[model samples]
Target: MRGTLGIATVVLSSLMVGCGSNAELKTFTITGERIIVKMETQDRSSGVAENSSEDQLVANINAADEQEISVVITRNEGSTEEVTIASGTFTDDKIVLEGSVKQWPTPIDIYVSRGNEEPMKLHTALLDSETNPNFVLLDFESSDSEDRLILSGVSRMLGDDSDKFTISGDLSSIHDQNLSLAVAEVRITSENPKSISGLSVTELLLDDSKFLIEGIAGEPFLVAIGVSTFDYAYWGHVIVIVEPGAQIEISPSATSSSFVPGSFASPLLAKSQIDESLHRKVIESWQNSKKYLAKMDEYARAIEKAAQPITLNSDVLAVWDPYYVFKELQAIEFASLTSIAQSLEDPMASLLAMEIGALNWMEYSRKLENWYTLASVFEEDIVSRRVIPQQEALEKQLDVVTNAKTIVKGHSAPDFTLANLAGDEIALYDVLANNELVLLNFWASWCVPCIDKLPKLRELHSEYRNEGFEIVFVSIDDAYEDWKKGSEKHEVPGVNVGDLHGFLAETPVAYGVQSIPTEFLLNPSGTILDRDVTPEELESLLVDRFGDIPGSE
Candidate 1:
């Protein structure tokens, strides 16, 4: 509800659209939590109405803090008198502007004119004789706020010739009225170059060959491959090349007169070679889904309009995969950036660039079975006479990579360092710190079932901890604060540890933990006893398997 916020009054009225050619200003009031907002208007029926007569609402960030946020609303993009209580926030202090902005049908964006506050921020940790540097994911935490925000940035030297860098982001509250207004964003987030390190930008354009090369071969520029449009189904190609200068030549290969001429068929990919293909498919998906992406944004807006009232709850949330979006978007950006480095002029520069790209791409190569490629199995020497000998390393890692079961119960747990809410250092070793009967519970906050078993777990903890029992609760949610809040909300009475990782977490692999609420019971001797056990059934089993001494809870 963007038209206003925090007015201690209430009123409602019916307004209809199409009855008039332009939107009319209707006044209303709302009351709550020591805040005041007056009146504004929108199309009666639709949430995101773009009419000339309607009031154009704008909100500026007045205050951000632990308690609450305050924003002043002005009616009409130009007029400052109209006020609307766009939305309300009683507890969490998050606010969104409701109602409609006057410049609806026209593009409402402030990006081409970027303000200082919103551009990407950067912090560097290295300096040397090196002429080039690469970007990587920078991590930071806020335990006081009980959260972690992984700030993503690029690592590359800027060129004066590079007067303008292309990136993506929307008005912070484009989705406030309804996530559906994703249509409202001036720049879509996918366009941003994340963690740019060494890229050899070649122009990406459509071409004639089945393999699209916008420019000459070896020209390495970032390319986003995927279906073009829904109705005009046909294959498309782009040209690419790599060179050693601030700018390079670029041209599109060609376009198909028919529907999608290129068959972006990921399904035909052999199961064994899925890793590489899946990575590519996800990239193509972003390109292909541009329309749906906008539709999804519209969907959010539609719901807010009451045109489609959706039940906002836990069940409805599974579709909003921030983690999936974060990784896939980053991967798409990474692959494009990686392609640039691979197209460089210097052999070593090109080699190092390609290797880095390969590392990132390969990280996601095998997670899906449909995207594998034969290029990864190459025996060619990368640089300096050293063969890219990863077969042995791959073998060692693959030895443990079993089916989904190993994601749950593997032979041995891999060790990695992560932080707890208090900034205390935590790891598998820390969780298993010199304790007998270590109880490891892998679950998440989104998982309703996991919460259901908490009481039984508490009972087991109470009964066995006095007898040297211990419990380590590991949550694999991508959002750090969400995990903390969820744990607190559930009152999880145990040693809690999480990487703030989304699904496909590295920790899960190390412990071979596949399923949520999967309980691994280890004996006093640090030997695995049962990989599959329930909280209700665990207490008795522990008592029976390992004789309990008196005074046990």
Candidate 2:
């Protein structure tokens, strides 16, 4: 049973909501003249009557940390007296307070502060001894230094049926972020779990002071919200669970003035403490993986030297090995999610894990199949809508890779026309007709490996130009300016042409140039003689064909 301590040195009566008359009651008292609240529960019942020999006030708080917090009772706007009612630490992430006052239906403010930060007001509520017997107050502050849209406030379960819940809150954005709010019925689809067209979509107007959402209880549903600043929009969602007759509140403090968006940053997203904690864990893991990758070479060398011949861990080796690190890191980073998808009781949490894991599915094909299977039971449309359709297109590209391999060594080279820097149309056959052997190089300005081979390509062109050996650079840079800048920056030799459509450029796609620094050696008749020929291999082939021609350097 819930009870309250009155302000004066007198006994007071307390009332409980949705409870029988047989419910137990406990008496509370303030030390000396100050009010001291002791709570046995996190939920607080509203007080409806004043302390006119009959009423009391009580409250309970649930927060993330066991920090020191204070409760102050104050009069309406113009009053000067502020009485410190309760001050203590949160125990087991919860704080309960019970108190009574001479006056009922009075306003009170709760202040919470951490470390050296100034005390900030966390909540304000009106209390009476007999009316308004249930209420909530919650506040949250994100430690993430990223652009975010914060929605926080109170939620109360009405009546006894547990069929419906009401959400009322203040929604604010850092960086003046623009967002939209939508509520949808979550469904299990044949291919995956998804939400159909939203049941309702509302533009989140900054001018609007507060918002409310009334949703069905018991069944799982979705609250979709996203903020867009530029061409890209970041989305965060949560599946909320409210127990019957429970009043919960969570809101962010108004102190995020310098927050800025990073390349990978999104707003602080959570519908509950669980959501917030899990999201933070995922973000930390991602950051740690990036830090490891940046020092992969250093770590690999150190570990290789430290390991003895008979004791080296293959798993550790694989994690540091340049050849295997990409796949290994992805697996290690998302391993927990795969486990969650298989066994977590909360399907909403599992769905979140699976969605994040699917972003890099191609890197871990075995995990991809498992995730897809798991998604069939709990998939979401937010990311999958973009990923699933692309799978088909990428699978087709795989077939192109196979066909491309078949055309090498003996088959005729695929012919194409593209423009050179001088604005002249250059065709493969045309270049092949002029040179005895041609190195058809497919590259992009942004490809590090392609840029690394430039000096050797220049050397080969200078040495073999007189012997009918040519290097034709087919740039797949998506823009003409990038292609021109790269070619000039590298001082490329021989003929230079650009498809200018990036990897999707007609020539590169026709030749199945999935990855770069892809090169094909073709003869005068346009028949492919080699694929992926290294500079040393090209040198030896040239020596055999030209026998160290007299003018060669």
Candidate 3:
């Protein structure tokens, strides 16, 4: 079940070479034997992995450009455009790379390409100081030839740096010796994984359950506990400010999902206080809001059974009534999170505070400006440079969705055509021409809320069909098969059609469909009369127009 093929001979050496007048420059050298391995061969002809000359190996660093010609790190789905700190031609059977940087902790990416095609990433490392020369190895196993060749390796900051500060912690409380401890520079964006450097808990226990962290010190950092079985789910992180010769202690627990510092309590304790306060306040608010929501639901049912309109207490309208109580709870959390982030002394800590605030792109569009403003200030520090750019990109996406969602009532509805189940193109204008009003409903098959509203929509459609009312169901399903199945399964009663591109499709984007089950009532002239009309509101409006329900007394 398990086997090992020696693809490369890794060398161990430490040589500090000088580069020009850069006194802060640090040198890195990587030497290893390179061999090609094929996972799936129809004929099991070869006993060992094959070596081919067609495969090309290259290395890159996140530093100033050393070569005029660009060398981009091509990942599976996206490419990371980085400055090449070092460059060289690879020999047939070995990979030898030497690079120098003005900073000690720099990022390195190794890739392999074939026949002038895009380079595929093989490994990534956050190279830093180490006492002993670190060895690099990659292992992959697969029975299927069509499957992708998985690349696996571990990189760490293992060496000694005299100028660095140390943060020591005790793992005696944690009995799970199989866990892995990760210490990463706190980042605000998705690139946080790239900053991670890990150490084995079993190995740390060997040193008396005491873990030592020595890195580009005198800066704030975060530590997280990752379980081996879970592939290191983020329990939580504690902000530690490294002081020269200071012993900062951290207790990381998997069961409680807590990572707090015993020493240096200023930032961690403050964050804890903020989180605890927010939690208490949210619970209190949700309890009060639940009573009102329950009463309102009961009132809605009463009105539905009576098949008539009823006026409720006016006081209920003003109490957490501007929007859903859930929205109010989210608003409270984000406001408190912003306050906590602003109170932190370290930019990195502040960045991490905002990162874990659970802000979304489309839903929290209004907060994008403020987040961008905060990230701009954080990017002033060199340590935050690794993640700020990506954060800015995420915020930019929020801005785009925000702008798109701003399509309000009174605006002309954007018209578009799509294919239905019969492979016939149906235009919005054609539907508008026949019906006095059209409920243009944007939904997806995977959306539960979208499916939940279908029965009521069908009822309303049946009731109002004779009164020149029509419903057009637009599905933003990425797959045609899924769309066809969902449409047929739901027995969607409307002019059902799909663009099959999800939210990114033209019709969805034109109509600003950020969330599913978004509805717009368009008049025969194609002007949006209303948006986000609830099922109850739709019934009331139809009643007002048609006098009463046909079957109701």
Best by TM-score: 2
Candidate 2 or 3, higher lDDT? 3
Question: Which pairs clash in model 3?
Answer: 129-159, 130-158, 130-159, 131-159
lDDT of 2 by residue, 1-553 (tens): 1112111111112222343345444322221111112211211244312221111122233333233333332223224434434333334333344554444334333333334534434222334443221211222122211111121222122222354434344445433333222111122221222322121113221123334433333333333333322122222222222322222222222322111222222222233333333433432334235443444433334333333243445454432343344345456556655556555565554555554543344444454554455446544553365336434444556656676767668888888888899899988899899899999998878887898898888887888888899998999888899899889988888889998866756677678787899999999998988899898899889989878766656
User: Model 3 over residues 1-553: C-alpha lDDT tens digits?
Assistant: 1122212212112222333454677677654332222222223354222421122122222123221212222112114333445444434333455665555554444554333434434332445555212221221233321212111122334333433434455444544232232222222222343333322111121133334444443333333322221112222334333322323444442222221111110011111122322322322232234543453344323322332223573333332232343354456545555555666454554555455553442344444554565656654554255356545555555554764656668888887888888999999999999998899999988887999899898998998888888999999888988888888878799899998877766777766667888899999999989998999998888888876765853
Give the lDDT ranking, best first.
Answer: 3, 2, 1
Clashes of 3: 4
lDDT of each: 0.38, 0.47, 0.49
Ranking by TM-score: 2, 1, 3
TM-score of each: 0.37, 0.40, 0.35
Task: Tell me the tens digit of each residue's lDDT in model 1 across 384-452.
Answer: 122222233343344335534443433444455767677787765665666666777788988878898
Regions of model 3 farther than 4 Å from truth: 1-405, 547-553
lDDT of 2 at 423: 97
Scored by lDDT, model 3 comes in at: 0.49
